[model samples]
Target: MKKLSIILLILGLLTGCSEKGTYIKNTTPYDEHSVENVLMSNEHVKLAKVLLYEDELLAGIRVNTFSRFKKKAIANKIQKKLEREYPDLKVTVSADSKILLETEKLINKKSEKNYRKKIDKIKSIEKEQT
Candidate 1:
């Protein structure tokens, strides 16, 4: 009887200490779906991708410009808009083909390991370009 009571006490303690509340894994200041919507609202953008890493914001946009004069302008507009909304974050936007390609690769990565690897690669590229 004493042994059974001790076993029950241990089990009760273990169950009491176990996790019980809801844990939210996807924590970010910005809503990803909203960011995509805002980017897509611009008519020139063919593709839009956004990633938030800690306090940094990375954006990749592929645009079909009306003329050569508007190519750089479109990228600058995206940067300005994001900067206005997320002033505390380091916002970087690019229309560069390299960045767009890398974004596509990042989007396609299936597993957590591959996703982390791609994020690291994007960070390296951002460092080099900035």
Candidate 2:
């Protein structure tokens, strides 16, 4: 009975750590599938929240615990790659939890009227941390 309990606990923990797929909210004409493919190509990314509004592309990603040390590098690499793919759109990517949470909130909003203002606020908050 004890051995069974132990095994179940381990399974529970592992399941809890499993990665959730990317969340993308796009208001533009861009192909969402291609963007998702680009983000998922990196093995270290655990969860990603992306918002595409007008000419701006903002992404907030969470890396696996083991990759936390290089999370900033990962964010930068994703940003550069995205910029190369979508040169006309301004790209911003960050691995900060605050940014991730804010981006998720933006993605879940019912209306799009204040998207630009809220996005600007989130960007300023991200800038303040640097």
Q: Write the per-residue lDDT of candidate 1 for residues 17-129, one digit (tens) a residue.
A: 34321111123666565466567677777666666656767677766635335757888887888788778777777777677667656555554456556766776785684
Q: List pairs with backbone clashes in candidate 1.
A: none
What digit string (tens of lDDT, one per residue) describes model 2 on residues 1-130? 9999999999999997676889998899987776788899999898999999999999999999999999999999999889888998989899999999899999999999999999899889989944
RMSD for each model, in Å, please?
Answer: 17.3, 3.5
lDDT (C-alpha, whole model) for all candidates: 0.65, 0.91
Q: Which ten residues in a row have the lowest lDDT in candidate 1?
A: 18-27
- Model 1, residue 67: C-alpha shift (Å): 4.5
- Model 2 spans > 4 angstroms off: 1-19
Write down the worst ten-residue block by lDDT for model 2: 30-39
Cα-lDDT of candidate 2: 0.91
